[model samples]
Target: MNGDWLLLGRDGRLSVYLPSDGAALWRAERAPAGPWEAPRRIGGDQELLPGLSIGRGPDGYGHLVAWRPVGTDRSDLVHTTHFRPLLAPLDWQPAGHPNKQGARTGTPAVAVDAQGRAHVFVRNGGGGMSMVAQKEKGGWEPWRDLKGRGVQEEPAAVTGESGRVELYAAVTGGIRHWRQEQPGARPVPGEGVDAAVRPGTLRALATSEESTTVLFTDDDSGELCAWRPGEKPMPLVAAAGPGPVSAVRCVIDGHDCTLVAQRSTSGRVAFAAYPSQQEALGAVWTESGPELPADAVVSLALDADGRLVAATLSPSTGQLRLARRKDEPGLALGPWQAV
Candidate 1:
């Protein structure tokens, strides 16, 4: 099967790589009140890895980021705007030596803060996490190391309520967290939260306000775990399953909410929603649909029509599948159809 790949744009459009040809594919609704549009290829030949990221700046333009290998030991962090015709390259490791085989490097994460600036975080070839921010007018600041070792997955980032940017990633024994209060401000180091999360399983979502929610699979038990600002990491559910998770903050039924999706032990994908950050810590999870394949990698998002959408990679067929929640009287997820 193809590697896990996905990009949820700020405009509620979901993009995924076609397994057959490695082409970029996107699906979205035509309008807020319109029907869902069929999935279509977006025109690209690059074979993207699992942790692709997409974000929209204040200018109403979307930015996509991914890592492209240029040589045996080097990979360039490439990005392109929604309106641009070509990808722009960003050197991830200017001074570090080329990465030999079997060395772990993290995927890139990008988020746009309130000031209309884009912030990017990625693991360098030297095994340290680094960050860079876009200038107000145009261009990027020099890369600054966040100083962590053994980061083998993509870092999680969010633009907080007060316009602060917070980043988190799995370190040696726990997760490292960092925050920048304002644009171009120095990053403040925070205490690492203790947890045995599996490498590459951590994902986070930030509200428009002050709280952040982190999700991961426990390395030992394989159960889903969550962490908020002050509270310690807690298990969202007790059963062990394949620990793929994705989260997003969106307005549901006219109320702001955080939605989290995880694979359950029964092979079905389940989802939970909290009206606010305070309620998420104690909220109950609701199962979305029938059993997906046990080995499927799942990604979740809300469509422009405000419907919950799920994309799954079928292990046996090596194809991508799309499913949606039927807005009937109850919470019913539709059957998975080939994209």
Candidate 2:
């Protein structure tokens, strides 16, 4: 969602969080708009694993989680936060490893609940999911098992409109899921839907105030499919993209829409817009723009002006690049710019 990377802060400014020597940030020079600033590393000497997971709490702090390599082999998850009036974040705090020996597989997922606690999830070295959340007063709870093996990739976690969270992991046979028993409480097992999904393509978007729908490419055919926990997976397109898809809900041409995009086989970003929950109606796909630096993490969000905007890390330049939906009725994106 918004906080995952290109965050629209409470102050109405935009902050693009990019992974770097630790992590980097690019905040809009002006609120509600940006001639973005040069990249600023969050200032830790630690080397960060390739991806980052950020959750913006209700209080406006951006809680960040990522894998920190411990020595040459083992690694542990670390945490940090950034907020207004402070461009530099607090020091990286060790959130600890899931395995007593250390967790080495899967990326971390972060989501902040209504009560302002940040929750982190990852597939552990034990071949199961592990989670850690903020305790009532502060700090983090010990890593606990959510229990599921064969997790294909990084799990997807999202907070519903109610501030409760649900996590989904694409596994060997189907989808594995967990949901908070109540807002801010520990998550419990939930019904899972059987489906064949590609690893690392799993993404969850809240389709309604109370429910979330996950999107992923079909493992066997590369088709994009969407599903809620109890429903059968619904195909959204005959073929999707080569990488994980990113989604954001917005109003397009006066109609409520869910816009999705990913790196296509041609190496450029491909996108589609469909009425929410109406994927059965059909998704018209469009290919646009040049390919990002290989393995770029793409993120989309509606600006305060309510326009579609996307940002991706440019590993080649070690900076951030951006593109916005053009001022046309269709899925046209203006030229990309290094921010």
The most accurate candidate by lDDT is 2
* TM-scores of all candidate predictions against the true structure: 0.75, 0.91
Highest-TM-score candidate: 2
Model 2 C-alpha lDDT per residue in residues 256-317, reported as the tens digit of each score: 78998776676676789999888898787787766666666678877667778877766556
TM-score for model 2?
Answer: 0.91
TM-score for predicted model 1 compared with the true structure: 0.75
- Which portions of model 2 miss their true places by more than 4 Å? 1-3, 21-31, 58-60, 101-103, 326-332
Work out candidate 1's RMSD over C-alphas.
5.0
| Clashes per model (N, Cα, C within 3 A) | 1, 0
